[model samples]
Target: MILTFCNQKGGVGKSTTLYHLARAAVASGRRVLVVDADPQGNTTEALTVDVPSDAAGVADALSDASTDTLRDVLVEGVWDGLTVAPTVGEALNAVRDEIANSHRPGWESRLRRQLEGLKDEYDLVLIDSGPALDTLSTNAFTASDGVLIVTQSTKWSLDGLALLLRTVDEVRRYYNPTLEVAGIVLNQHEALTSGGKHYAGELEAAASENSLRLLTPYIPKRAPIKDAVDFSRGLDEGDYKARPLGKLYSALLEQIMEGTGR
Candidate 1:
């Protein structure tokens, strides 16, 4: 299954969800390939060892066979059946320009083509998209079998969900018609305060109060979540502290294994 974690806004746990989910899927014994579609390279750095000088991850992977291919570099190992088609810093803005030039409507199919080439090689392919509805997000969504839309429980964030739903709807109708809106997950939920608890409660309450299907048992705000990995830190120590993130993601994975039940 190809699952894209997307949102059109930043600071809403898009990368975090991708990181934890992909790692959790790996820990769970699934061969997963991660596509880091964002230019920020957050997912790429988190997963990879060191960076090259040029850092044209997507360009090297897609446009040329001689350049260091993302598939060859990342997919060389079978870690718990997980692989990655990672992105490096400064990926082709050319993709944006090319999409603009092509009057054809298959821009979203690019990732699909790449994945089809590697389909027989893995069990699941996960695409971690940027927090915007750009060409990258389009590729991730169109290439995916379903999407896991993440949002912090806030009025503004909730408002943005409408636009995401619309975009996925278009992908379903036109691009990848089989793309399913798997479910919505509420992240960083906190029941400690009235405001925090209220937002969390509203999402939990949404199912009974409306037609919307909300994923059960939302992910709460854990302190380690916002902390970036200290690359200089000892590898073993870093692994120990990051356990909470893994556990949280494993729980989310378990819940996702359960359907909407509508």
Candidate 2:
């Protein structure tokens, strides 16, 4: 299954969540592939330290029609069972205007066709998307089997969700008809405060009204999570099960797998 972590608004932990969840999935003896679809290359940089300037990444794959050639750009053994098709810099973004303004039919499904050739090698594939409804993000939606919406529990984020859901619906009708909403995951949750609780109530109501499943064990703001990113290490490195973020991520992984059947 291809699960894309997406939210048009940034700083909602799409990269961070993919990083932790990829680690958790690998620990469970699953062969996982991470597609860094974002132009910012946060997930690529975090995993590969520095993407080489001349390296062939997702840009080469998307720019060509040769379906089976994407594997040439795959970076293997990044972290045990995880392999990455990294997107660095703005090479892929350079074609955004042409893609948006052109009258080409079926250009939107390029990434999906390319990924379809590679889905059998891994048990799961996760994509980290940029904070925009651009060509790259639309390609990710076209390729993905399901989308996992990541957002903070706030009024502004609720508005963002509505906009993103509209885009998702468009992709479903025009691009990938089998696309499903895996779930909504609340990040940086702090339910102790009154504002947090109020937003939590709002999220619960929104999910119910929309007939969407809200995944449990919301991720909290924690130091270890930041440290893991800073030090470029997995959260489950050393006695991490004792850490709050570690336990929360494990539960979140379980919730995701259960909901998505991956």
User: Which candidate ranks first by lDDT, i.e. highest?
Assistant: 2
Q: Which regions of candidate 1 fall more than 4 Å away from where they truly are?
A: 60-81, 204-213, 228-245, 258-262
For candidate 2, write residues 1-262 as lDDT tens digits: 8999999999888898888888888878889899988888888887775568777788778774424356878886357898899877786676555567666887898788788789999988999889999898898999998999998877777778888989999999998899999999999877787877899899899889989999988887667786787666777784444255676778888888888776
Clash counts for the predictions, in order: 4, 0
lDDT tens digits, residue span 96-130, model 1: 55665666656667777767777667666778888
Clashes of 2: 0
TM-score of 1: 0.83
State candidate 2's TM-score: 0.93
The lDDT of model 2 is 0.83
